[model samples]
Target: MWLLNGQSTWVNGYFYPGENIWAQCDLDCHDVDLVLYDRNGRWVAEDTLLDDLPIVQAPYEGSFAVQVIMAGCRHPRGCAVVVDSDYGF
Candidate 1:
């Protein structure tokens, strides 16, 4: 998924406490961030590293969302990001 600078996408799912989510991009993308938000959009966990891979963990079990943000991309147009999780069947 290609996203422009400062662009964000939301992933909504049912996650148990301690679940994990990962956002990975190619070398073209230098900075990507993942943020975990509660059902009410409250902040939970986040990974904002200078590397292309970022991850976050679930703090509570219930309806929650993960926001993927593209902070910086070496690509001209946008950065391609793949979001994955260890939870779910």
Candidate 2:
């Protein structure tokens, strides 16, 4: 089993208006959960059982942070994660 964790360094809520933003996470898990939130401590989005090129798109044009947790009947030995951001359309 493996674990890979990463996130956007930009501060949420500091993003300019009308900014297009997106985040992509790569992971392999028997069972995994992904979550996103604003700097103000608001739940933005979440997903469960993410595997094989899982990606999440921001609903609004703003800054936010992402959190991912992996767990299941059998623990993951190893994994890899990468995060990137882009401007809003």
Candidate 3:
């Protein structure tokens, strides 16, 4: 969590198309951002606001990877976050 300014960690899963998926971390990981990529490593959707909650809509049915990046970490111990993700139509 407390690494380079652009450190990224990814979590992968299979999701159906035409649904909204979202991910969020703890308060301490507020500066972190979420990026959604398809199985082919194609960008689909992303939520990069001041808020920690990120949401994306899947354009196709396939396995996707959610990239969590530490845009900025103020905590001395870094930004260790527990991400909970789910999909819904």
Which one wins by lDDT: 1 or 2?
1
Tell me each candidate's TM-score: 0.89, 0.50, 0.73
lDDT of 2 by residue, 1-89 (tens): 23533221322433344333333333343444556677676886666543533345567656677655543323234444444345432
lDDT value, residue 20 of candidate 3: 62
Q: Whole-model Cα lDDT per candidate? A: 0.84, 0.46, 0.68
Candidate 3 lDDT (Cα, 0 to 1): 0.68
The candidate scoring highest on lDDT is: 1
Lowest summed-lDDT stretch of 10 residues in model 3?
80-89
Question: RMSD (Cα, Å) of candidate 2?
Answer: 5.8
Higher-ranked by TM-score: 2 or 3 = 3
Candidate 3 segments exceeding 4 Å error: 1-5, 87-89
Ranking by TM-score: 1, 3, 2
Q: List the residue pairs that clash in candidate 3.
A: none
Error of 2 at 65 (Å): 0.9
